[model samples]
Target: MLKVAIVGYGGIAKGPHTSAWKKIENAKVVAACDIRPERLDLAKSAFSSNIGLYEDYKEMIDKEKPDIVDICTPNYLHSPIAVYALEKGAHVICEKPDAISVEDALKMQAAKEASGKVLMTIRNNRYSAGSQYLKHLVTSGQAGEIYSGRCGWIRKRGIPGKGGWFTTKAQSGGGPLIDLGVHMIDLAIYLMGNPKAVSVTGNTYSKFADNTEKADSSHATFGQAKEDGIYDVEDLAMGFVKFDNGSCLQIEFSWASNIKRETRFVQLRGTKKGLEFRDGIIDVFDGGRNTKRARIKHNVDARKLDTGIAKVLNGHEANIRHFVDVITKGVEPVFTIEQGVDMIKILSGIYESAQTGKEVLL
Candidate 1:
């Protein structure tokens, strides 16, 4: 049996990660760690009553000696914790953005190499039903030669953890660009055949730091919001990326912006047909002039694509299952540490470009 211990018993680790572990055979959550005593209680409620809980991650890892260390902590702690876990002979599966900076990401990659242990980050978006269909379209020569794409997750007013780690640059990296950007950006690039991002140019804004508006988005309740916390990170970020394969991606992410309701989408322009995944559904557009017709467009789902419906619809749960499979059953990994490093490099480059007001080459 593979023993798994999770760091940061937050909403994600408690809800999706633990729940998925319950459903997976031969893998058990042996322990959980968090700084907050309340969170440890919550973890106990979520997991077994006999499950070990710790306030210090190092102490937990040292004592438990878990085979797997799942990290769902704040952005800044990802690298340090992952490195320590890997060195202590534990496979690591971390939540998104990989690491806050390129340097930290590289450290994780190096540790994984030296330890000879698996390291996978949560690219949960890739496991979504729509995302799976899109992947089929791209790989099956339907969405041929994906050339350009546009992806974004924008919110009119949905800043999470107003004055907490989510708002602090040092703790959570930079606002939506790192928090939410990793989701859509990684999905887009994965669908686009994981093209190498060569250069990036971007801009960031912090307009709604003190707005104190009631959030209409369900996502606003993710992190605990403080009364008067630091809101130093950007609320909005726009960027463009040029891939090595000549394909480019345009991205925009905002925790708060003066726009319509919350929407998350990914659109790709391909030679044969274009693909768009907005909200949850996917649609394919065929601009080929057949007869005197203008264009052809149709909705596509897992049923139509014949891809087996996932037992776990939640992408987070499915991703966790995949992580378990890769470790216990020797299944090939879909997410790699190298990709995590590249993802951090792209995000960090965009932030640097946002500051320097110039394109940053990767």
Candidate 2:
């Protein structure tokens, strides 16, 4: 049994990770730490086995010496905490966005290399049956050569206003681009075989965030709202990425928008087959003498697979299992730090493109 220590006992810790850990046969949550005492208390109440709790995560690490450190912190703190965990001889599983900047992502990669420890970011979208099927189609030469793709996440006025950290540039990084778009980006890259992003052109907007009068009407949490403080982050962002393989991707993300539909979708076009998913249904259109449509069905618990926390924890478990198997049985992880670094670099390029009003060449 691998002893696990969870850092940051927030909504995610309570919701998904805690529940998922219960499902794992040989894994246990040995320790949990959070900056807030009440959060730590909540965790102890939930898993009352004399599970160690501490306000300082470092203290928990030093005392428990867990085999795995699961980081569910904000985007900006991912690097520091993950690096610290790896250095302390614990394999690390970090919640996505990995870090706020490319430089920090590289630093985390360096730490992982130096420690010779497993570091996996939670992008659970890749573990979904739909994603797995799609990957199989692409890799088995069924989808043929993928040319161009469009991937986006659209939400109608879904800004998490209650968390000031999310709106603050220093804490959560950019809004939906980093928070939600990262998942789509990861999926796109995974499907495209981690192609090098050659250039990016993007744009960001925060017009809706400037108006606070509609805060409650928008269903956003207001607990962390400051009456007159800065809310400097993008409410919507869009980007175009050109890959080294000559294929391109158009990406879109929005936290608050007036759009009619709130959905996450990816459309991929290839020489032999085309795939599109909308409203949880996967459709494949084949390019052959007799064109046909194939409807794909996935086996998944709808109740346990919807939320980001659930998806992330599910992916985390898969990653942890792979890491353990690789370490003990001499196998290899499906994904690597190099692929993660490339994703971050692409994200950074998109942000730079939006900032400079010009295409950022990789």
Pick the TM-score winner.
Answer: 1
For model 1 the local lDDT of residue 299 reads 38
For all candidates, the clash counts are 0, 1
lDDT of 1 by residue, 181-279 (tens): 999999999989999999999999999987977987878888888888899999999999999999999999999998968899999999988888888
- Which segments of model 2 are wrong by more than 4 Å? 213-229, 287-320, 327-330
Instruction: For model 2, state the Cα shift of residue 219 in Å.
Output: 9.2
Cα misplacement distance, residue 155 of candidate 1 (Å): 0.7
What TM-score does each of the candidates earn?
0.94, 0.89
Off by over 4 Å in 1: 288-311
lDDT per residue (tens digit) for residues 204-253 in model 2? 98877666545433435522456555578888899999998899999998
Candidate achieving the largest lDDT? 1
